[model samples]
Target: MAQETANSQENSNDLGTITVEAEALSIVTEGTESYRAPLTSTATRLDLTPRETPQSVSAVTQAQIEDFNLDTINDALESTPGVTVERVETDRTYYSSRGFEISNLQVDGLRLPMPYNNVHGDIDTAVYDRIEVVRGATGLMSGSGNPAATVNFIRKRPTDSPQASVSGTLGSWDRRRLELDVSGPLDDEGRVRGRLVAAGLDTDSYLDRLHRERGVLYGVLEADLTDSTQLALGHTWQNNNTDSNMWGALPLYDSAGSPTNYDRSTSPAPDWSYWDGETHRSFVELTQRLSDNWSIKGTVTHLDMLSDTKLFYIGTVPDASTGRIPNSFYLSKFDRHLEQWVADIHAKGNIEAFGRTHQLVLGSDWSQSRVQQSSLYAAATEDLPPLDEWDGSYPEPEFGDPDFVHDVTFKERSLYSAGKLDLANRWTAVVGARLSWLDHVGEQYGSSQDTTLDNELTPYAGLIYDVTDQASLYASYTEIFNPQTATDRNGDFLDPIEGTSYEVGIKADVFDGGADAALALFRTEQNNVAQLVGNIGGRDVYEGADGITSEGVDVTLAGELTPGWQASVGYTYLEIEDAEGEATNTYIPRNMVRATTSYRPASLDALKVGARVRWQDDIERERDFDDSKTRQEAYALVDLMASYDINENLTASLNLNNVTDEKYLTSLKWDQGFYGAPRHVMANLTWRY
Candidate 1:
C-alpha cells in the first residue's frame, strides 16, 4: 500500500508536468532544489525541515563547523540560537534553552537516558557531520521529559571515495591538540565501509595549579548484508584528567555588597587535589527495507563512566583576635561510577488514505542506568599546601577520612507513534502521543529501603500551511511529563512533573536561493515544579510547591544570502515568571542577540575572514522577602576567525575569543556567586588527502 502511494505521487508529478501543463502558469525549476530538500534525504531517514517539522529546528552543518573551527560538542552548539552552554568543570558541562535545562539527547534519532545531571561522552561533535536541534516540548518524539528541547547528533558516514585528514592545534596556556579522521571502503565490492576518528588534547588553565589532559577514539563500520538489509557498529572511548578542578563559582561581592573581582589566577582547590574521569560507549544498529516505502530500524547501546576526584570547598571560620572576621577551611575526596544501556525499535512508512498522503512513525524504547558514589571528608587543616605539590615536588599528606557509599538505579520504558498528513496542496497536519513508565531504586550501604515507580502519557499536535512556494506558516502544541525519583515524608515517590508549550511561527526561503529564515513566538507553562525551601547541610531539599511560566520570541537567519558571502543571525526575546511563588513577576533577561558573517572577497582566493558577536539584556533578580532590592546586569562577547587555504589539501586557521578581553560572568547565583572564562587564542593547521 505504501509503495502504491509513492508511485501515485510520482505519477501525479509526471502528469502535471506533461499533459496538464498550462501556458498561463509556468512551473519554476530551480537548479538547487535538491540542496533545499529536508535533511532526511541526507544520510538519515528522518524528515526534518525548519518549515515542515512543526517546531523550531536548527541545523549546524559541516561547513559551519569547519568555518568556526569547533572542536567539541559544546563549542559547536554555542552558535545555535536560543541555546546556552555553561562549563561546570573541565569535563562537565550544562545546556539550557529558554530558562530550562535540556535533558533529551539523541544519537541517530534514538533517545538516550539522562540521569540527574549526568553528562555523557558519546556526543562528541568531532566525529559528526551535523547537529540538529528541535525546540519546545518534544514529547511526541522523546517520550517523558522537560519542555526545554532536544539535541540530535548525526554521525559522519563513509563516502564512496576515500578521504583522510589530520589537524594540529596550539593555543594559549600551553594547550596542544592533534586530531585524525580517515574513511574508505572495506570491501572490493563496495558493500562494506568504515570511518575512524581520534584526538588528543593537553592544556593548562589560567587558574593556578590547574591543568587537564583528554583523548577520544571513535570508529564506525557499515555492512550491506543483503539487497534490503544493512548493519552498523560503532564504538567510542573518552578519557579526561584534570588537576585542581574548580567546583564552585567565585564570590562576586564583599560583605558590604560592593562589587569585587577575584584574580583570574586564583585556584580554589589545594595543590594535592585532582580529578580523573573515563567513559566508554558501544552501539549497534540494523536497518531493513521491508518495502520501497516501508522500513524498520533497531539499535542497541551501552555506556560506562567512572570518576575519581579530590575536591575542596571553601568555608568560613571565626578569627581568634577580632572574633568578627573569619578564617577559611576546606573540605575535600570522591569516587563515582555510572553505567547505562538502551535499546529501541522504529518503523516508518507512508500511506494514502482519506484522499491524502500520510507519513507514519512508530517506535519503542527501553533504558536502564545505575549510579554509585563514595565520598570522604578531610579534617580541618591550618597549614596551607604548596602549589607545586601537584607537580610531584612535595610529599603527599593524609588529611581525609573514609565515608559511606550510596547507590541508585533508574529504569525507563516507552512506546510512541506519530503521523503527518498532507491534507491538501498547501496544508499539512501532525499528531502524536507517547506512553512512558519509569522505576527508581535508591539504596544506602547500611540504610533503609527505597523504591518507586511512575507512569504517564503525553500528546502533541501541529499544523502548517504554505502561503506561497517560498513561505510557510505553522502552529504547534505539545506537552511533557517527567517522573520524580525523590521520596516523600511517607517514603513514597512523588508524582511526576507536567508541562505544556504552544508555538506559532513563519518560515521562508527569503532570497528564493539557498537562504532560509524563521520567526517564532512561544509560551510554556510548567506545573508541580520542585522548589528548595531549606538546606540540609550542603545538600538542598526541595518540595513540589510552585508553578512557572515562560514566553518568548525567537528569530533566525542562516545559509547563503549571496554567493561568496554567508551570514547567520539569531535573536530571542523572553519573559519568565514564578506563577505561584512569592517571587512573582521576576524577569529573566528577555533579550538576546547573536550574529556571524564571513566573506571571501573573490580577489583573495585562498583567504577567508569571519567575525561573530553575542549580546544579552540585563537579567533582574529580586529577593523573595524584599522585592524592592534587586540585581541587574548585561554582557556581550566577540570572537574572530581567519583561515588561509594553501592548497586543496592544506589549510591553516587562527581563532581569537573574547577579543576585547572583557571581564564578565556567564552564570550567576547568590549562593554560588559567578562563573566566567578568560580571553584566549588558538591556531590550527590541517592537511587532507
Candidate 2:
C-alpha cells in the first residue's frame, strides 16, 4: 500500500534535524513508510542515529514489510542483507550472519530466549513497526550471543491521533490472510494511550498435503503519570498449527549416494502428521525522566511456550530401479513446555567529562527458565508402498505413554555499563563491559547434569573519527560468551565458547541524510569449540579445539534517492576456515546479494512500483549418513510489487515472488532438504481510517 512519510527532513547538515522526545516514540517507525531509520540503540543502548553507531546496522521498515508481503519472521529476515535463513524442517528455522548462527532474539530491546536453539513457530510480523539488525558481537548491550548479529523487533505503539486499518490478502495455493490494527488515546486529556493489533492466516502449500493455520494478537496501554513518570504494559500471543508437516525433508540422494531428482512437490509426510505451537508473552515497564537528557527505566517480562508434534521420518535411501525402498517404521510424538521470566533496570544520560558532554548507560538484568519435555515412539502398523506410488494417505498411530522425559532449568544474571566520550573535535570513543553468571541443572534422558560459570566478563571498545559532516571512519572490538553442554574425553564438561570480533568501517549519511551507506571489514574468532571423538557405550565424547575463524566484507545502502524513490541494497563476501585451515561451514554461501527499490512517479501520483532481487553463490554440505556431499548451485530470484490508491482511504496492491520460477533447495543444513516455493502471486486490499 502507498503510504505517506510520518516525519519530515529539512536540512542536510543539522545533526538534530528531527526531534523525538517521547519515550513511546523514541525511535518510531510505525508510520514512517520509509526504509531509512532515524535512530537506533541496539548497538549501544544509547539513542543514536545509524550514522553515529560504530557497528553495521540495518532495518526492515513497515514499508518494506508491506511491499514485500513479509508475512513471517523468516520472510523478513531472509531478505535482510547478510542474513541466511535455514529451513531445516517445515516448522523449524535457524538464522545466521557473518557465518555464525544468531543465538538470541529481542522484542523492544528485551531478550527472549528460543526453544532448542531454533525458531519453532511461524512468528507473524503484523504487530511490529520495524525490525532492526546490529551486526557483530554486542556483549555490552546484549547479555551473551555469537558474533553474528542481533535482531530487535520494534512494536507498533499508540498514535497521538486515532487511526485504524483493515486488510485482506489472497494468493496462490489457496492462501488467505486478514489483519486489523488500531491505535489511539484513551482519555480526553490524552494522558493514556492504547493500541491493538490482530491477524490470522490459513494457507495450503506447494508441497503435497501440507497445510497451515496461524493467528496473532497484541495489545498495549501507556499511561503518563505525574508528568515525568510513565507506565506501560503489553501482551502478545501467537499460535501456529500445521498438518502433514514433515519431520524431515525428502531424501537428497538414493542408496548409491547418487542425487535423487525428485519433483519439488514430493514429500514423505503422512496425512496424520502435525506440528502445533503456541507462545504467550507479557511485559510491563516504568520510565522516569530525571532531567532534559537523563532517564531511567525498569521492566519485567514473562514468556510461555507449548509445542505438540506427531512426526514421521524415512532415513533409508530409495532404490529407483528396484522399487525396494525400506522406510523407517519408528514414528514419534512429542509434547514440550517452556517458561521464562526476566527483569531489567537501566539508566541513560549525558555527563560532563573532560570538558565535553558524553553519553553513558548502566543496566542490570536477570533471567530464568524451566523446560519440561516428553516423547513416545510408536511402531508402524503396516507399510506396503513404493516411493513412486506413495501418497500422504496413512493411518494414525496409537501412541502409548511417554518413554523418555527431560526437565531442565537455566538461570543467568548480568551487569553492564557503556559510555560514549568525545575525545576531540573530530574523534570519539566508546567503551563498555559486562559481567555475567550462569547456572544450568537438568535431568535429560536418564542422565544427570549440573554446570555453573561465574564472573564471566566481556569487553567492548570502539573509536570513531569524523572525516566530514556526512562521513565517519570507525573501528571496534567486541566479545561474547556461550556455555557448552558437551563433555570431553575425560568425562569433564568443556569451557564456554568465547567469540571475539574485530571490525573497521566507514559510514556516510548521503543525499543530505536522505540516504545512508556503509562499508565494513570484519573478522571473528571462537575458542574452545567442541569437536567430536569416537563414541563409547553409545555416548559420544568430544574435544575442545581452537575453533574457527571467519572474515568478510559487507556493504549496505538504504534511503530515499529522490522525491519518491527509495532503495535498500547490500552485498556480502565471506570466508570461514577451521583449525586445520580447511573450508568450514560450507553450507553457508560465501557470496550473497540483496537489492530492493521502489518508486512513485510524480506523473502517476496514485501508483507505486517496486522490485527485489536476491542472489547467492553455491553452497554444499557433507551428508551425515554417508560421506557424499549435497550441493546446490548458485541462483537468483526476482520478486515484483505494485500498488495503486483507489481512493483517499482505500488502496490495492499485488506481489509476485520468484517470477523467474527458479528451483532451489531451501537449505543443506541436513542430509534431507526440500525445494523452495515456485513462482507465486498475491493481491491485497486495505482500508484505512
Candidate 3:
C-alpha cells in the first residue's frame, strides 16, 4: 500500500504567491502503533528504530498474529519471509534462512538453547507479544551460531489498566481451541502489576488416526522497588502430546526407482505410537537506572524440559499393487530430560566523543545444560502381518522395560562489549567483540568422554551514513563459529565449523514515517562443515567439507499506508555452492515471495478484510542411494480472512487457508517425501473487557 500526496501550484502573474506543504509525518514526534512496530531491541540490545539500526530486521506484531489467526511459532515462522521450513514427520519440523539452518534464539534478551531435532518447534505464541528476527551474523550478542539469523521473542507484560480477553475457535478436522488473557494493576498506585495467560487445544490431523492435545500457562509479576528501579519474575509451562505420530516421511520411490505418489492422508504409524513433551521455565529480571541515559540490568532464567516417545520404525516401501508394506518389526522407546540455567548482566550508557555523543554497552553471560537420555530397541523374530490393505491400524507389540543409555552436560561462558561512535557529520561506526569458552562431557554404557573448546573470539563491525532525514545506507562484517557433535569415520568429533558474513544495504522510512522499506545484499562463506557418509557396522559416520558459499538478496516493505490500510511484502533470492562448485541444499527454494494486506473501510467502521499469498520456485533433490534426481514444480497458495465487530466488546472472525486445496510436496530428502497441508477453515469469537 502506498500513500498519496496532492500538490497545488498557482501562477504568480495573475494572483498572489501560493504555498504548499508536505503531508508526511515527522520522525521526531511520531508514535508507532501495533501494526507498525518500528522499534526493536534485537539488533544491539538498544531500543532503536529499524531504519536506525545497521541490519536487516523484521517483526511479526500482535496485530498481525490476530489478523492471520496464527496459533503457534511454526505458523508465524512459515509466514515470515526469507525463512524456509521442512517437516520430517507430523510433529518434527526444522527451519533455515539464507541456506543455513537457524539455531540461535533469545527471550527478552537472554539466550535459550534450541532442542535437537526441534521437539519444541510447536511452542504456542499466546505468551508472546511480538517476534523479532535479525538477518545476518549476531555473534556480538549470541556468542555462537550460524551466519543465518537470530530470533528474539518479546513476552507480553502487565498493563496499567485492567484488561481481559477470551477467545474460542472451531475449525476443520474437529479442531478446537480456547484462550484467556488478563492483565492489570495489583495496587492502587500502579506500582505493582500482574498478568496471566492460558490456552488449550485439541486437534485431529488430515493424516489418518493422528491427533494432538496441548495446554499452556504463563504468569508474571512486576513491582517497582523504587522510582528508578524495577523487579520482575515470571514462569511459563507447556505440555504437548501426540497420538499415532509418524517417525519419518512416507517412501518416495519403489524398488524400480520410479516415483510412488502417496496420498496426502496416508500414514504408516502403528495405532499405539505416541510422543509427549513438557517444558517449564522461570525467569527473574531487575533493572536499575543510574541516570536518564544510563542503566544496568540483570536477568536469570531456569528451564526444564522432558520428552518421551514409543514408535514403530518402517524400513521398506510396499509394492504399489499389493498395498502391503514389509516391516522389520522393531519396537522402540526413548526418553530425554534437559535442565538448563542461564544468566546475564549488562550496563549501557551514553558517552561523550569528539564534540559528539556516543553509545556503549558491556555485558557478561553464563549458561549450563545437563541432558539425560535412554532408549531401547528390540527386533521381532516372527514374520509381520502382510497383504493387508494399508490402513492406519496395527496390533500393539509387547516390548517391556529397557536399559539406560546416555547422559551429557554442556557449559558456556562469555564476555562482550559494543560501542557506537559518531565518526563525522553523516557517518557512524559500530564495533563489537565477544570472547567465549565451551565445555562438554558425555557418559554412556560405562564409557566416558569429554571435550573442551576454549578462547575463541568473534568480532563484529558496521558502518552507517544518513543519506537523508528518513533514509540511511549501511554495510557490515561479522564472524561466527559452531561446535559439532558429529563423529568422523574414526569415531572422533569433527572440528568446529567457522563462517564469516558480509552485508550492504539501504533502509528508509517513507510516507511521514508511516511506512518502512529495506533492501540488502549479503554473502557468507563457511568451512569445516559436516557431510554425511555411509554407515558401517550399525554406526553412521561424517566427513568435514573444505568449504561452502552462499550469496543472496532480500527486499522487505511494511507499515500503515493510510488511515485504515496496512500491508507487508518480502522477496528472497539465494544460491549456494559446495567446494566442488556444485549446487547444494536444493531442498530450499532459490526464490520465494510472501505478501499480505488488510483494509477497513471508514463507512463500514466495524468490518475488516485481508488476503495472503506465498509463491516459490521449483526445487530439486538428488537421492544418494540410487543417484537419481527429482524436481518439484513451482506452486503457490492463497488465503483469505475477514472479521466483524458485533459491539465494543465482542468480535467474530473467519479464516480460510489453502483456498484451492493444492496438493504439493513441501520437502524431499534422502528417499522420502513430505506433503503440504490441505485446505483448512477456522471460525472464532472473542470477548474483551
Candidate 4:
C-alpha cells in the first residue's frame, strides 16, 4: 500500500508526532519540517486521497468533537452526512445540503461572507478546532454557491509541549458552558510559538422566553526566521448576544389550511415582541516559506453584525368571533447591518512534472460585503390578543397606526482564482473562477424606482481518478449566480439567478485501511427561479419565471471498521422538478438518513459508547396556497452518548438528544412552525494541562 503510506509518513516523521513548526523553518530535528505536514495525511483541500477528494468530503475531528459530546457547530454538523440543521428561530439557523441552502462558508481556508438578513444568530461552534465538509459543487474551491455544501473551519494552532485545556457544560434548556485552551513555547529557542482560545456561553432556550450570551477569543503566533523562513500570526474574536429571539415560523395550519394542534408552548408573538441580536468577528493570517518546494499564504478578514428586531406575525383569523384564533401582526422596528472583507493570496509547490511528483496550487481572492436594512411597520388592533406563549416578560409594543418605512442596501464584490494540478501518480485536476459584482437599493416611504446593478461569472471544474490505491473516481462541474433583491410582480427588479451543478463520485478506503466510503450522483439546475406573485403586505413577492431541477443519490460511510469500532453513515435520494410555466413535475421527498455508532473497549480504556440515527422523508408543498398542503412529516430520530476517561487530564460526558421525543418538524415557515429539540440532556467536564 505504497509501503503503507510510506510507513505512515515515516512514523509521522520519525515519531516527532507530526512535528509542526514552520514560519520559515529553522527546526533542525523534529522530522525536519516537511512543509508542516499533517493535513490528515494528504487531501489538503484536494491534493486527493481521502479516497481522492473530487467531492463529498467530511472530516470532523478534535477526536470527533470530543467523541460526540459535540459542543455545537450545530453539534458538529450532526456528524456530517448530507447535513441538515434548522433552528430557524432562537437566533435563526438554517442549513441544508443536497436540498440546497448552505452558502459555502470557510474559515481557515478563507471565504466567509453570507448573511443577508436572517441574522445568522452568531455562528458559534466554540471557535472551531476542526470541521470540514465539502459536498458537491465547491466551485473549484468555493466562489459562488448551491451544490449545497462547503463548511471548512479549522483553527487551533501553537504547540511544542505546554498545553492547557478546560471545559464545562450542562445542558438541556438552561445550558451553561465554559471553555479554554492554551498552548506552548513562546520562546526559549522554540522559535516562538503561542496559542490561546477562550469561550463562554450561557443559554436558556427551547423556545418560550429564550436567552443567550456568547463570547470567543483566539490568538496564535509562530516564528522561525531562517532555514527556509517562516512566520505566522493569527487572531480571532467573536461575540454574540440574544434576548427573547424569534421571528416568524411556527404556524402550521388553520386558516382552513388544516392540520393544527398547537401547544409546543405556542408563541405567535405578543408579550410585546422583541428579538435582539449582535455579532462581531475579526481575523488575520500569514504563512511563508520560499524554498524546498515553495510556499506562501496570507489572509485577512473582518466582520460586524448587528440586528434589532421586534417581530410579531400571526394573522389567520384568531377571533373576530373565534375563526380559529390566530391574528397578531406587528413588525414595529427591524434593523440590520453587516459588513465583511476578505483578502487572500496563496502558492504551494512540489514539482517534477511528467516523471512523477506533482502538486501545485496557486490562488488569489478578494471579497467585500455590506448590507443594511431598516424597516418599520405597524397597524393591527382589534383590542389586542396574541400572546399565547413566549413569555420572556414582553412589554414593548405600541405603534397604533403608522405603517410603511423601509430602507435597504446590499452590495457585493468578488474576484477569485484557483488552481490545482497533481497529475502523474493517479491524476487530479481542478480549476476555478469567480468574478462578481452586485448592488441593490430599495427605499419606500413612497418608492421611486429604487436602484440595482448586477454582474456575474462563476465557474468551476474538477476531475480525479486513482482507480486503485484504495479506490477513487470523480467528476464535477459547477456554477451559480444570484442577484435580484426583492420587488417583482411589477414592482420591477428581478433577474440574475442561474445555477448548475453536476457531479459523479465513487470513493473508497474500505476494510483494508479500515473504512471510508462514498457514492454520489447529482444533478442540479436552476434558472431565474423566483415565483410567487401574490401577497405584498403580508410578504411574499416574486417574479422572475421559474425553472428548477434536482436529482440526487448520495451515500457515505466513515472510519474505523474494527478495533474498538466506530462508524458513520449517510444516505440521500432526491428528485425535484418544477420546470417553469405551469408548475410541471414535482416530486419532493428528498429522502435522508443518518447513522452513527461507536464503542471503545480495548480492555476498558476509559469507557465509551455512542449511537445515533436520523431519517427524513415527508415534505410536500404545492404552494401558491395549496395542492394538498403537507409540510414536514416523515421523521425519525435517536441519539445517545457516553464517555469517561479519568486519567491524562480528566474527561466525563453524556448526551442524549431527541432520544425518541419525536414530535418532529425541524423547520417550516410561512410564518414559523419549527420544532424539534424535545428530549435533551447534556453533561460534560474536562480538564487537561
Q: What is the TM-score of each candidate against the true structure?
A: 0.86, 0.95, 0.90, 0.32
lDDT of 2 at 341: 96
Residue 554 deviation, candidate 1, in Å? Answer: 0.5
Displacement of the residue 265 alpha carbon in candidate 1, Å: 2.9
Least well predicted 10-residue stretch by lDDT in candidate 4: 28-37
Backbone clash count, each prediction separately: 0, 0, 1, 16
The lowest-lDDT stretch of 10 consecutive residues in candidate 1 is 1-10
Candidate 4 residue-wise lDDT, 215-245, digit = tens: 8787777665544444566666666766655
Considering TM-score, which of the candidate structures 1 and 4 is the better prediction for this target? 1
Q: Per-residue CA lDDT of candidate 2, range 487-573, in tens?
A: 887777888888988999999998767999999999988888988977877778998788879999999999898888988899999
Better of 2 and 4 by lDDT: 2
lDDT of 1 by residue, 548-614 (tens): 6778999988766666677778898877777643433333346888677677777886888887777
Off by over 4 Å in 1: 1-46, 89-91, 118-124, 316-330, 383-402, 443-455, 485-492, 530-546, 581-588, 620-632, 673-675
For candidate 4, the per-residue lDDT at 642 reads 84
For model 2, state the Cα shift of residue 311 in Å.
Answer: 0.8
Winner by TM-score: 2
Per-residue alpha-carbon lDDT of model 3 for 1-689, expressed as tens digits?
A: 00111211101110011110000110101112235556665767655677767777877767678888888887777667788777767777777788887878888767776645354427898898767788877877776778778787777766656878999999999999999999877887777878899999999988878899999999998777776677779999999899988777676765556676777877767778888999999999887767767778788999998989887766775555554556655577878899999999988778896799887888899998888888777664433333233555566666666666788787889998887888998898888888999887887554554667788899988898999988899998988888787788898888788878898999999767778899999988888888888787777789888677889998988888877787777899998888898999888899989777788889996998988888889988886446787778889988899999999899999999999998888776445666787999999999988
Instruction: Please identify which of the two predictions, 1 or 3, would achieve the higher lDDT against the true structure.
Output: 3
Cα misplacement distance, residue 237 of candidate 4 (Å): 13
